[model samples]
Target: MDAWLYNGKDADDVFGILGIRAEGSRSMNSRKLVVLDEYINLFNARYPSAATDSFIVLRDGFGGEADFARVLSMAKLRPESERMIANTSKYQGELFSKWMVEDMLEPKGVLSTVLEGGSYGTARSEDKLVVNHYNVFYKRRTREQ
Candidate 1:
């Protein structure tokens, strides 16, 4: 199972930009530990197969780092579990600006390339363009062979 978790304010905007709808809610503001526990429980329940994979996408500047830290702590508690954080930034603007070579623009080309292509693409586009302009973090628990 896969889930996209965004801050309440940006949820709708993100959905619109991605041309997809997501369940908008403000749930991560609760205790971080509680959220982590709930995530682990839900993951275990939803993906019972050892070979199945699950992921979560979180927006930066909205307690994303804190939530990722909690996931790391969860990994420590269960050595069999693994978690990783992939952070990125982007400068969104008109389509032409994204492909321009000019040094200065409304969304500076060089800045966009460095932040979006260099960091965001390198991290998230390893497989495919799953989500844009969002930091992706994932946890995996595998059964011992």
Candidate 2:
């Protein structure tokens, strides 16, 4: 994770350049995740010390379920990053989307979540999302915005 964050060679390395900082904590199963402005990052670890990092870029999910489904479909197009997003860490296969919305309501995590039961329009896409288990304020690309 640090490698890509500092190297800037990998596709997700932009996080480092953007001055984004990642804060991580281990789940009961010892898994990790990193979410921030426009991104939902999930970490898969095989050993206690080693982990493979991947992320999903949040798109327009303001339309609720329809937008979530669309964002997920587009996420699948990313053969490399989609691997983690498709893997469910929670019951609804939401990848902690519920918590993301909560984070914003409290700790200012993501402005809103994009899953089936997520909140909408609490924030603008331009707002920076918080990092850790955590967080999307994706730009509005719709005609409505």
Candidate 3:
């Protein structure tokens, strides 16, 4: 199975720590919509047989409310950065949830289950290491009738 990770910040630094090829994208608004489309293309290209499975590791901030709030409380970020984070978190959470229910759960969809987990790493600044939580959504072909 192929695996990919998504985050708002530059992912190359933490890719080794997470053991996945991370792709950085806004994951909100219409700015980086193509990122998701690219991901779908990559998935299809990697799993051309239609019977293979893939994994997408998403930052918990993309869906976890409590975790996002906790990060906001602890991180010393600028006002604009804080607002952006909050907005993106809210938007991505709703979008992801909808995709999970309407798309992933449908027949022959390319998703099986979303599993939650956490990882420890330092930010780009490298000031200090912190726990970065995430969700790993497994994508696979649904059973054929």
What TM-score quantifies how close candidate 1 is to the native fold?
0.19
lDDT of 1 by residue, 101-120 (tens): 24232322322443343443
Against the hidden reference, what TM-scores do the models get? Answer: 0.19, 0.21, 0.23
N/CA/C clash count, model 3: 0
Residue 29's lDDT in candidate 1: 22
User: What would the TM-score be for candidate 3 when compared with the true structure?
Assistant: 0.23
lDDT of each: 0.28, 0.30, 0.33
- At residue 126, give the lDDT of candidate 2: 26
lDDT of residue 95 for candidate 1: 20
Instruction: Output the number of the TM-score-best candidate.
Output: 3
Q: Considering only N, C-alpha and C atoms within 3 Å, which residue pairs clash in candidate 1?
A: none
**Descending-TM-score candidate ranking:** 3, 2, 1
Estimate candidate 1's alpha-carbon lDDT, on a 0 to 1 scale. 0.28
Q: Higher TM-score: candidate 1 or 3?
A: 3
Tens-digit lDDT track for model 3 on 32-121?
333444554555565565422111223442334333323322332322454456544554445345545564533123111222222223
Which candidate leads the pack in lDDT?
3
Candidate 2 local lDDT, 1-145, one digit each (tens) = 4554344333244434433222111111112323332222322222324333332322121233334333333333332443334332221134334443433233232334333233345433322222222222122212225
Q: For model 2, name the residue pairs that clash.
A: 103-109, 104-109, 125-137, 125-138
